[model samples]
Target: MSTVLTHVTDELQSIFDRARSVAVLTGAGISAESGVPTFRGGGDSEIWTWRGRPVTELSSAELIATDPQLVWEWFDYRRGMLTSVEPNAGHRALAEWERRFEDFTLVTQNIDDLHRAAGSLNVLELHGNIWRARCLRCASTFEARESPLEENPPRCLACNGPARPDVVLFGELLPDGVFERAEEAAARADLFFVIGTSAVVYPAAGLPITAKRRGARIIEVNPEMTDISFIADVTLLGKAGELLPQFLKERG
Candidate 1:
């Protein structure tokens, strides 16, 4: 192994051996490798040329209330994108880690459901999944089906009113119960890993720092340097799918 990998391997082994609790945060880059399109710009046709819409415009709470149809159309497009993709090697590695480590927590920002698809059991999705919908009236949540809705917007079975994706939209607060659990996990972690994220998104971005403040060793695995890299005790600069397997091998 090269110098960087050698250092990272040693650091990870040391952390895993000592840590009773571990937390892992993942981002879009990990899913991108699994054939999901990057949110760089418009539709697939203008992949490289077009600029993408802001998250706020696409997910504003106001937009969902005032123009539910528009928001639903946007979600439909996103759903199509997600449906075409599958979990990659990195996702599987995390799932395997969860199986091996009894106290490991897998936290993700993406709403693609790839982590669950890869067999991860203990996951906290900071942003909600697109595959699930929630009733705006009764708060009942259910898995979205492939069939078309009869109305412009789908109605909830419980309340017979409009239902929206369970995801945390722009201008909407994060799910109350989920973040609390993630924070607790971070605070108790002895080892924390940040993978595939830019570490720019708030609240979620603060998770690693929370663990760091509590004396947990931080490791970053990414192909490019991000804001969190400076805080990481060891930085493994490579694709997560490739790096994770190698790191685990070194541990063995």
Candidate 2:
């Protein structure tokens, strides 16, 4: 049983050729291809729970304050899981695009460090990185990549204070400056890519519209139809790991 291949349109190819400043927004779907389960997706129920408590409950600011050890333990388990996952083809393709374009910005909702691992330099992480920890006292941050980290609720080197995962927890606001930069990139882009996202989560969901309002062509790459799919100049329906590489090849 063979499925018909979806070919990239000549119009899309032409848009790629003309694009100089490119901005991309990626979501959990991209990392899901690399075996990291999305928050709303299924597979390993264990990833979402610890001792019967939901990760959603364990990963909040309130939880961090009440039970920092439990929160750190859950994050440590997740970090261990991510240790074995590597950047997929989609990540590699974006990294390549950054090198090819005059100005490239990769904005992601994922906490996974896979984009940086894949060699992307200019990335704006909407949700902070899972591999980094922020000091509750000093507000300083440092990379904490060691899996099953030596310290649960790792302490800050600067102030002997408790730290939490740098990720934007449930109910927490997106870090200052990150979203502003993303909006700037969106406004400046000649081409905007909405990749692997459901296009429902705002402020991030609003970026595609911002780019479009600024006259950037919106190209959506996703397996499912998203909330913003209606605005896409072209929608390439598929997994990003496959479609992004194919898009690059077609443009070449």
| Best candidate according to TM-score | 2
The digit string of per-residue lDDT tens for model 1 on 17-98 reads 6778989999888887787766642224323322265645767798788988777777777677777678988999899888
Query: What CA RMSD would candidate 1 show?
Result: 3.5
Write the residue-wise lDDT of candidate 2 on 1-252 in tens digits: 112225566666777878899999999889988998766653353266678988789889888888888888888878888988999999999999999888989999999999999999988999999999999999999988888889878889899898889999887999999999999999999999998887688889999999999999888888876777788877788889988876577433
| Per-prediction CA RMSD (Å) | 3.5, 3.3
Model 2 spans with C-alpha error above 4 angstroms: 1-5, 41-48, 250-252
- Number of clashes in model 1? 0
The local distance difference test score of each candidate is 0.79, 0.86
Model 1 clash pairs?
none
The alpha-carbon lDDT assigned to residue 221 of candidate 1 equals 83
